[model samples]
Target: MKKIMFTGGGSAGHVTANLALIPYFRQENWSIHYIGSVSGIERKLIEELPDVRYWPISTGKLRRYLDWNNVKDPFKVVGGLLQAYRIIRKEKPNVVFSKGGFVSVPVVIGAWLNRVPVLIHESDMTPGLANRIALPFASGICTTFPETTKSTTPGKSRYIGPVIRDELLQGKAERGRELCGFRRDKPVLLIMGGSLGARRINEAIRKQLSPLTSRFQIVHLCGKGGVETKLESNNYRQFEYVNDELPHLLASADMVISRAGSNSIFEFLALRKPMLLIPLTKGQSRGDQILNAESFRKLGYAEVLPEEQLTPDSLLERTMDLYGNRERYKETMKAFDPGNGIKQIRDWITTIMK
Candidate 1:
């Protein structure tokens, strides 16, 4: 069997697209190996897969800010590079697939130095610092949006859209209703703020829960350590996190309230779910979420409510607006093509290996 090494992870976003390709690669009978930070969310997630081998390496986050860690991280990056280089030399995988994160930088460099081809995927409108650093080493880069093409090396990049999990579209609304304990009267509103929930959005939802629950039942995916048992209503259900039930919850919902992460927004677009997006501000991120939201709004797939205006009133008002304009939003999403990039991506992986 041929061999492939996958490297990506600072967050679940970096790993999920790779996950979408895993089962397909398994069916094709390839030896799969993953290189990631020893303690990253990626190791926890990828370790659960039955057939893949996981390799841990040192990694330091790439921060754009003036962080104290800046003094120490370069050494870690160097250490990671050495570890990755050793792994690549030993494994001799035919190709390396990266999903663009700090951990990916060392792996990409190691693969390139070892005479292996690298394929990178960037899910954001703008390339993260890690991907920018790794670009010179990659053989090709796949992007989630057309706008991202201009940000990459001209000929090396292509707009292939996102790799959405097939199971997401298989969701059953009846199953969702049963899980959320819905009585079938009010519409369901699913609120998610990435893998780790957004405190601002969570607070706004709880503060306006009384009024909001009157019109719609809520299925809140409030990341780990975010559940609140003190405030409970029959119309509102809160879970710290979700995995299997996510598709059903998404399918059952009339609309979404979310952060503007590219992977998530594209998933919502694929499901034709109208969204009220509250993007992360500059203080929190490099403003990619803001750009992602603006693009979605411009495309008529969603409405944006800036973080500065994330009060209970604003959130509820925007949600009401999303609900009112849902059909128009759904129509826009229906017309969108996030591309069947998974097949193309899989083909590229095997072809590159060959």
Candidate 2:
């Protein structure tokens, strides 16, 4: 039987694409193995699949800032490299697929050392530190944004657009409304602050909840530990995080307020949901979210609100603006073609294996 090794982790964004692709390989009778950090979210997500064997390895955070962990992280990465190399050697996989997170770097290098072809999927407009390091070793790079191709090695990069989970497209709006106990009298507004939650966005949204909820039924994904138990309202509901119910919530949403993560924004684009994008500032990241948000803005699918300018009043104004002009955004999004990313990437893997 053919075997494939997969690696990526740290955030849900890194592993979600892999999740979208896993079912296909399983149906084709391929042996699937996953390598990820022992304690990362990827382990939990991947382990839930019965057929895929999950391997835990040492992994270090790849930070752009100076820190004492910088001194110790190299050792962990080296250990991960050695572990990954041994695993690849023993498994003798036909290929390795990476989703581009810090944990993926060692696995890509290990695949190269093992003489196995590796394919990488980069979700950001620009390659992150891990993908940048793995690019040289990868046989091919798949990008979500057409603009990303300019930053990658020529001929190696292909723009496949976004890989969306099939389940997300099958959500029922009525089910979502029932779950939130919301009536159809008002349009539903969904606010997401990314996986870890955005404190400022949370504060701003809560501060204006009374006014906002008056106009729109609200579903707030508050991220981990971000939910406020003291707050209560008939038209407003909050979740710390969602797994299976996300699609339903998304289906019921008439508009979205979210952080500009590429995977997420692309999903919104695919769903034709108008958005208000609040990207993470450069201080919080490498400014990739800023680029992602701007790309959407230029395409007329969303409105951008820089974090520095974010306030309760500003949030309310921008959200109202998004709702007012939502039809235009939806029309623009309808013109977008996300392509068949899952099929294209699967074809690439099949070709490389042959």
Task: Name the candidate that leads on lDDT.
Answer: 2
> Model 1 residue 146 lDDT?
87
Return the TM-score for each candidate structure.
0.97, 0.98
Runs of candidate 1 with Cα error greater than 4 angstroms are none
- Reference-based TM-score, model 2: 0.98
On TM-score, the candidate that comes out on top is 2
Give each model's whole-structure lDDT.
Answer: 0.90, 0.94
lDDT of 1: 0.90
Residue-pair clashes per prediction, in order, are: 0, 0
Given candidate 2, what's the lDDT at residue 283? Answer: 98
lDDT for model 2, please.
0.94
RMSD of 1: 1.2
